[model samples]
Target: MADPQDRRPAGAAEVLERLGRLSLRELSMESLLQTVADLATTVLPGDLEASVSLLVRGSPTTVASTGQLAVDLDERQYERGHGPCLHAARTGELTMIADARTDDRWPDYTPRAAERGALSSLSVPLDIDVDEQVSGALNIYA
Candidate 1:
């Protein structure tokens, strides 16, 4: 069988166009998050894994993920209460780890992520209005 990653869209434009066609307002939050995760994996470089982490009932949860690896990585961060995705969701800032194994910031998270085959990661905050009780981060792992 062919590698599934090889079938993803080759360019950001294609991903963007696909996303733009979605009726976001009509979709449930779960569906929207799944679409975002799918687009992230398709648009981003490398053999990427993608997930969306969101605060549900004041607890962080992986709302949607491209693969089990993404969900597992997010769970690790949630358990530790720190990681690129959690930091981004809480601070509304972008966090990029060029190499998780060598990143000293999250001594707990990096090694686990590296062990899971995630060499690098990027986490970007999702802009939800203040009235919305949801804080989210788009996490891409490679």
Candidate 2:
């Protein structure tokens, strides 16, 4: 019989198991988020990079990132005030750009991100709130 773990997606089990072992009480929010960003890149099939974008008091900030590309792309979004990551954080909706070069949803963002070598992107909203004023999203790029 095949092990159930084999049926699961790549890195899913590892990420979940690692997360389960975390001492949430001991880690700061920034540390926890950084771990999540790092874990995200491991699950995807390509050479991916990730970042954690937090929206606080209507401003967006990159709190943690796995690489410089992730941070640069995230900042591009923040500069425009609307991009996959920011949209996901603000709306709690998942945003995906299969190909940044052709994605026109964010005319101001996609082109620049593509120029910077981020050909694809995925932003998953995080249901995290801090003092009723914070929202977040996990952003992945490749």
TM-score of each: 0.90, 0.89
Candidate 1 lDDT for residue 105 = 92
Best by TM-score: 1
Q: State the C-alpha lDDT per candidate.
A: 0.85, 0.85
Mind giving the per-residue lDDT tens digits that candidate 2 earns over 1-142?
A: 1222332335678889989999989999899889888777667766678899999988999999988888999888888899999999988999999998889999999998888889999999988885648899999888
**Model 1 / residue 125 / CA error / Å:** 0.4
Screening candidate 2 with a backbone cut-off below 3 angstroms (N, C-alpha, C), the clashing residue pairs are: none
For model 1, what is the alpha-carbon lDDT of residue 77? 94
Give the per-residue Cα lDDT of candidate 2 at 58: 80
Error of 2 at 136 (Å): 0.8
lDDT of 1 at 41: 72
Q: Candidate 2 at 122: error in angstroms? A: 0.3
Instruction: Please report how far candidate 1 places residue 77 from its true position, in Å.
Output: 0.6
Count of steric clashes across candidates, in order = 0, 0
